[model samples]
Target: MIHKQVVNHRQIAWLVGSLLMTGMMISFLRSVVQVARMDAWFSQILPIFYALFIAYVLSGLVEAYPGKNIFEILFIIGGKWIGGAINLLILFYIWIILAIDIKGAADFLHISLLPTTPLEVILLVFVLLMMYYGKTSLEVAARVNEFYFPLYFIMCISLYFLLVNEYNVERLEPILTSSLDRIVVSNFLPVGVYGDIFLIGAFLHAIVEPRLFFAAMKHGVIIVGFGTTIMLLVLLGVMGFMIASRLNFPIYILVQQIHVTDFLDRVEMILFSVWFPAFTIKVIVAYLAFLVGVGTFGGQRHYNTFNAPCGWFIVVSSIFGFPNVAHIDQFISYSLPLIVLVFQLPLAIFLLIHVRRKNKGREQSLIPEGTKLYRFYRSMVWITTVCLSGCVIVILIGDFFKDKSAVGGIATAIVFIALLLIALLTSYGEMQALNHGKQKLGRAKQAGSFRQ
Candidate 1:
């Protein structure tokens, strides 16, 4: 229940653009290159479909329920218990993402900028800054993004130009030569990377011009997509996939190669300084999402009360989340993509279905009085219940048979079952409420007739 603040479309665009672009300049390039090889640049094209679909769905949601963010819409569609459960789940996901970014950024700084400094101190300072940003209103954060993104963008462009002399056109040869399985799998990588587009839903209510929401998101996604693709191509052409993939931070290595003259040797430091604001914006936005979700679920009007405690928790978790850089790389390369899809895609599709029903007026008409439609709706509900039960049973049996350590898999299965049960309960509650309201109206109408 955070107070809504109006932000212009340009500010929203800048914030999102900075968030997407920040990850591109970090360890993400190496992950993409690992799967797509020299054609990793081409893989950037694959996420456009995901971005467009998500944008379209979010825009429709905003248009249908003006001035209500996704969390409020979820409450209307699913009721308090179910919607709060989903919000908690999304909040957990955002927390994990923020922690991972904090850890990664701190690791980068420790390795390159402050080799002698304690990692704990670095993480503490970074998380404190993010907490400060989180405490501020969304409008303030949006204004900060508007101010810094242009400087960051210009630095990126200049970095590309500085590396032009190092590009080798021959390195990009033999495109599409990777196995079809590998290439198709490679596409999912970027889809996960770009999944942050869905986060824009949380901020939709604060946007000043609802009609321009989709346009702003589209422009930001396009800029990030093309910027990443071009940067990957340059990295591959200049350093080749072999050298680029081996480096912990390929973009840093690429920047290190830029030597304009005798005096301009260590320009990588300058690039590093320019990129920090973009990275900070990413963490701040994620933290903002966590604050908003928590507040919305707890029925609080403001989230500033929880910011410090959550920030401290994130700082501790990030410091211990991964023992070292290799663990971070492994999670990014394997676990991250699946986690992103599991949490993001199903929730989005569910909301899309609900929004469609709402827009069509089918939501209220589903249980029409004394009609076949009511019976049909009941039948569909029964079928859905049966299917969900079967899914739970199948998942339990599969985990028991296939997993050596069934704890994680079983936990996941339980969560899915809980989600289904919540949805069913919410629908029942809504039906009961609707029927009670209709009966009240009938009684009032009878009283009016008697008075006449």
Candidate 2:
């Protein structure tokens, strides 16, 4: 058996922070600007809320199942057939995300820094570095994140100051005037970017301070949220939405505009160097998740053994996945949000229900009849049921009235109802079990008093 390694909360925070910052810093913001126009920054807010909810749900799973990662938790809740299917789906999603990141990085390098170099060579070198990191333990990855966090922070700050003179406050004027349809569509665009935080589910068990996991995750996400928000503001304010939308890599273009003096031009080269490690961290995390999923599905104790093959697979897929960068941008804007939500939202709801049921079972065993704590626990269950039911209703109603894509909306509504039903049944069963336990305890206490 491979020995598990534990990393502190700070390391976890840095890992998540780096992943989010790197993802946002790439070409993602252009999609948001495309939809929301000057109000692009508003689109980011919804996804932050979505990300926090996911973090909360995943954290509940961690607390319920102590040291189990998402794969183990899935098996426990879903059993073999259902859990295995979900696991495979998640692995496929991770593989695609990994491939995209690899391809994106290679494309960026080829376009900007290594224009003369062959794309294959650029991809090969990057993949080798990624495989080297992936072959090592996740602890090493965490440490790399820790080391890069400060440098990433400094570079972001420097970039902001460098571009300060170019910002036009008027460009961000007339913010909320965007059409409701466009705003709603834009709101969903960044879902995939923020949903990347869900990758933390894989590393939950490795957190040394499990009790602090949620807090650390929240902190990390806030860091990402603020950083991305700032970068978006800078991009919009500096280049305006039209130009920013047209640029292939808006942030890189914004960096290219940094001309402090004749000598200080071309600072983007230095910024790119600083940014490379952060991008690598994202690739590493995605690759690591892919490896973990493979190990979990295959029941292999030594996941690292598959590293070379998987890394090469990513290399080949990255090269052949899309004909060009335009395809990638199209996928990110139109396809990725729905794909990410399809995988993440349903799984989160399932895990949340599963963890709540398990916790209620443990409470039933421990708590005495008529105790305040037990009563409070039961009340909480009712509250949860009401909240979840309300969410399902709202989603169904919204889908029926507002969503333009009828099939997508209907599919989402169906998923919501299925999750709601599962939660209700679990809650009802736990209530029954709790009531029985209370009755048994009551009778025992009465018998003891009578005998005395």
Candidate 3:
């Protein structure tokens, strides 16, 4: 059995924020422009639901599994073969996420802040830090997260002071406008950004008291979501829709725009400083998730040995993941949400249902065949599938409705469709493969026992 260790409540909370919120805000600021255009601030109002929903699902998992981390729960519900498959996919996901973060940080610094430094140098430095932290236990990472989270928050809140002249409440209005569909679509930005919260489930084993896990998880998730929404709203208010949507690094740009005085013109540098701690937290979270994944499936007794190799692998994969920065932006804006919703939520739901079934001493459950709760969950499965299907349809329709003669518009649409299809196919294939492996294992075990 893996040993349990203590992490402070404050660190756990920051762990959630740094993992999902910090670097995400950079991407979120850039992507929100796709739907809301000049009304990006207005679109953000919808994510309160998305953020809360994600937290609720994660918290539910903690309640269902109690002391188990994500990998242990996967093993229990899916069985070893299937569970291992799912676990590996999660590992792949974390690795890819880390790559994106690395590339993004490198690109931002190279173009916006540091032109002389090579991309490789930036990436290597970041990965080195992540590797160092990854070697430590989850408890240490959590404490570090706790320490840095406040500094990151201070940097974000400092925006209000620096950009007071830029704030225009009127930029928030011309509200709603029969654009409910657009508003929901806009949710893709923050949803993709915030989906990293699921990684926190990997740390559940570190908490000794099973009952306290869910409460702590819920508290962390809700607080992080609340903080992100407020920060995004404040950013919109300070930058206005015009500038915020156009820039690749809206938050960074807003900080650069800060001119409290002539000498203070370079206050934007402080953002870079604060971003290090935030990024550090994010890297550690991804590293931990990847470590859990490898340890589950690769027969490794310890996770430290794989950290260096995994870091290098992530760097190489990230460079090839996107043909260019534009493609990365398009993927995040147009396709990432469907992947998160379909792949993540279903896994969590299956785990929760499986645990609940096992705890009730039934292979299935004792719920009446057509009980309300059963029916509701059944409906939810179908609804989720149908809603995701509709998202695909709507995206296609939007592409068809666009002016085809415009070369740039057509190119963007093609890239968008291709990326979405790739993500969907990959997620579906992994989930199916994992489930199938579990079923086969159960049958094999039964047959072996019969022969005996």
Candidate 4:
């Protein structure tokens, strides 16, 4: 039997992070700004955690089917027809994403890089290159992403420092200017952007260290989430929410504003060198994912066998699939998150029910259930999170609730976050202690068996 290549945890984490950074950074801003207004930066936090929670919860499927990708697991647990139907629905989801992003990136380039060039020409070139790269396996893509992701990450982070002079703290003022309900509901868009985390399900089988999947996602979520929050923060500080929200691509404009030294006026192109790869790599990863789903569906050994057709289909659909960038933005803002949740929650519940039934008598625990100590630590973590969340909310929106100002609310929020971090660290320490104990017990059992 031919063996599939495996990717380590770090590779999976960085690959997923790079994939998410593209969409969130590129075109995810306008909707959130419109809805959340000045508080758009704050709006990012909840959706990020939401994505991580969903990824962690659905990972039960990975533990249940230790040797299979999501596609394979669905085939086994969902049965042939059910699995086939679900996979097909996934293909549709992937197609819409590919179509929208491919078009969005193309439009961005046509507007930014090659204003004189025809948009269709740009689209054709981008699609051909993506198709060529998509032919490569996930292992190859992960390696390339790992090698260059650091440079991309460093350049992005450096933006905060470079644009420090442009920052106006006052712009972020009147904290929580948007209505609480609107801001909460506005989360659906950025959260929809974070919903790309769901795509990680496709590649779980490629993970060489199955035990480290959650750790990998944690790393990915932190990088993507932190990066996005900073981007929104910088934009708000630089241009204020009013200007930041009105623009089609605020990030692009933000980059253009960087006047490095007197001689170097527009280094946007230099950053484009960084941003282009960041943008295209996500599309490339999506392409690879699409091929995986299709390969399983059509039973092809070489995923590229259908690459041309799929590539062209995406290209044509992209051109006509979205009327304009506005439509894409609106869909991402309003529609996509719901679509992702509708598909994901049901599928997870369906798989969960089936997994419990099939593994009724089997060892359902992967590592171990929460011991009493572990549960206690876990409760502390939850309490700390709630406290921190309350502090931030009270500081921002407490004006509506009380007559007196929420004095020192920011300081209170900072203190709560520090405590939350301690809670998390202690919880991790307890987990390690528990794991060591379990390992010793397992070794003792093995020794007894061998003696017999």
Best by TM-score: 4
Per-residue lDDT tens digits of candidate 2, residues 15-40?
87787778667687898898888767
Residue-by-residue lDDT tens digits, candidate 3, 1-452: 13445664446556766876677655556677557654343333234345435555554555566666778877887788898789877876676677777777778777877799987788788778878877877877777667677788767656766677877755544333325466556666667667777777777666543323333443444445445544555666776566666777777766677778766657767667877777877877787778767776665546877778887887778878864566667666666666677787677667666656545642232122344534543454344334334444544454454444344333433443343333333333333332343344467578862110
Name the regions of candidate 1 deviating beyond 4 angstroms.
361-452
Instruction: Give the TM-score ranking, best first.
Output: 4, 2, 1, 3
Best by the lDDT measure: 2
**lDDT (Cα) of model 3:** 0.61
Error of 3 at 387 (Å): 26
Which of the predicted structures, 1 or 3, would earn the higher lDDT when compared with the native?
1
Per-residue lDDT tens digits of candidate 1, residues 1-452?
35658876667667767767886676877887888787676565457557756876897797678787788878887788898788777777787778778888888889988999999999889988988888787787788888788788777657667888887867865444445456566768877668877777777678543335655665566567656766776798899888888889899889899988888779888877778887788788888888887778767778888889989998898777876777777676677778778878888888788777766752332133554444544554455345444543544443344334435444543444453444334333333433443444467568852110
All-Cα superposition RMSD per candidate: 14.9, 10.9, 12.9, 4.6
lDDT of 2 at 307: 86
Could you tell me the lDDT of residue 233 within candidate 2? 69
Candidate 2 lDDT score at position 381: 54
Model 2 poorest ten-residue lDDT run: 423-432
Q: Residue 84 lDDT in model 2?
A: 86
User: What ranges in model 4 sit over 4 Å off?
Assistant: 1-3, 356-403, 406-409, 412-452
Point out the higher-scoring one by TM-score: 1 or 3.
Answer: 1
